[model samples]
Target: MSVSEREKSYEWQVEDARAGQRVDKFVTAQGEWSRSLVQSWIAEKRVTVNARAVKANYRLQRGDRVALRVPPPEHLAVTPEEIPLDIVYEDADIVVVNKPRGMVVHPAPGHHTGTLVHALLAHCGNLSTINGVYRPGIVHRIDKDTSGLLVAAKNDSAHASLASQLSAHTVERSYTAIVHGDMGHERGTVDAPIGRNPNQRQEMAVVRKNGKRAVTHFVVREKFKGYTLVDCRLETGRTHQIRVHMAFIGHPLVGDPKYGPKKNRFSIQGQALHARTLGFTHPRTGEEMTFEAPLPQDMVDILNRLRRESGL
Candidate 1:
């Protein structure tokens, strides 16, 4: 693939404040490019420093001329919809919202509307376009069924900062889940490698080869006669990471459609997993902040039922 013929080129002159910074990283922070995307452009020779093709790591001097050509996004026409959103916090840099169960984060293959992006577009029109046409402000993704607090970047700088924190494994994310079986230990860790399932192409599994390393630390919060409530801490953010890892440990989350048991015990809509706590440094201020969201009504109702019927 190549840059589109109608590439939009951005020009920047490095100032004293940005002198000595790496060219790719400097451009990434300037609100138009992502770090990885900038690096890719540098490799493609679409980025030039001082009228010369330079490496991604090239340091910029004051008044250095930088030109970058980026492909224009497809006019997918993701219209703004005035869907009600559970806004927890909002600022110029970021907005934190509690996504309810059953709402898609962004446009999938065929589906485009009714997603969090659509709502965000209506709520906050100015969103970071780093993620592309569909996922404008999305920094990370929670499953369609798992309800939780998620943060979105309003600008590219904030997006880059948050993405950097996630990559460094410094972001804190915790979840509460009701697993199918009684966990043997009070606390445990599942250290495994997860990759796309070889058998089922749509699913993820603990594949030995070509799998990314994943780890989940769990603590038994409350135990019942047959089920267990556990708090899970994620160290890696792979697709379906918590669900796949918990299932690997023989205690899949209850109501998990793709990974749970076939027999019906709980008439839950989706996985009994809730993202409870999320923590990260502020993109603009560098302040460490954490937020938590309570369990949804469905999960709460099920837990109450379980407590009354089978107390442990």
Candidate 2:
């Protein structure tokens, strides 16, 4: 590897004394570094061994020499622009934003600016660069067309604390969704493994061996003519976990262009899913904090129309 890839990096072998321990703990013990630093490296996806990125909880085997390459710190520029944002809540540590539909959380290829991060940089000064240059303060993200509450960390300390909460599954993330067909059960849970689709690189699939555990609990809030409004809580956050699981269970999200049918029984632009609520322990104050975003007009209108037709 190049020198730049080695400066903010290190390598160590798993001695017999440290075998069978968690990778993060093993790395910390071997390097004399703080556990928090090791955890950050894990979260940043910087630590690898034998050309594979392993999770922090991965058990280390004896004689396993892990190579870590920490990239250079991203220096983000704060350029102000007139990007409109719906600020939900703001504190010294974090910002809760009610992101509108069709807003990308961060920049990707072909989408450099006009993102929530760029807008945040324009509105707020500097943000935590924990996730890297592309996403400064983004702790979590919603889909481009999915609207609702999202939290942005303002400093590294807050980012670390929030990351820990998310890692421990302490943060509460709930979504409101409209799915086709009334579920057979009033409430149900989907415990399935999710991993990258082997055949389709762009999608996620349910796999037993190479997949990560994902759990989604969903309850039917209201039923329409042939659809259902459900509340979903994420026990584990994975890419498209909700959509994939819901689709897997034969209740694909309505208006979902990717997973659901092309034409919904109703007319809508995108999937009728909203991040209705998010709660977490405040990093600084050690107090429970929660934020809620009511359904967007499109969703509200869809539900209202459904209710009107159903007369419920």
Which of the numbered candidates is closest to the native, going by highest lDDT? 1
Once fitted onto the true fold, the runs of candidate 2 whose alpha carbons sit more than 4 angstroms away are 1-18, 22-69, 77-80, 265-267
- Clash totals for all candidate models: 0, 0
- What global local distance difference test value does model 2 have? 0.85
Q: List, residue by residue over 1-312, the lDDT tens digit for candidate 1.
A: 345537788899999999999998887776545566778779999889888999988999999999987876656468999999999889999999999989999999867779999999999988887888788989999999999999999998898899989878999999999988888999988989999999999999999999999999999998877888999999998999999998998998899999988765776778999999999999999898999999988888888888997953
Clashing pairs in model 2, backbone N/Cα/C closer than 3 A: none
| C-alpha lDDT of residue 247 in model 1 | 91
Tens digits of per-residue lDDT, candidate 2, 1-312, equal 655444576778778988889988767555424455678888888888666888888898888889886666645653545699999999898999999988889989777768999988877787887677777888888988899999998887888788778878999999999998878999999999999988888888788978999999999999888899999999999998899999999999999987898877666677889999999999999999888898999998899899999998
Q: Candidate 1's C-alpha lDDT? A: 0.89
Give the deviation of candidate 1 from the true structure as CA RMSD: 5.7
Error of 2 at 96 (Å): 0.4
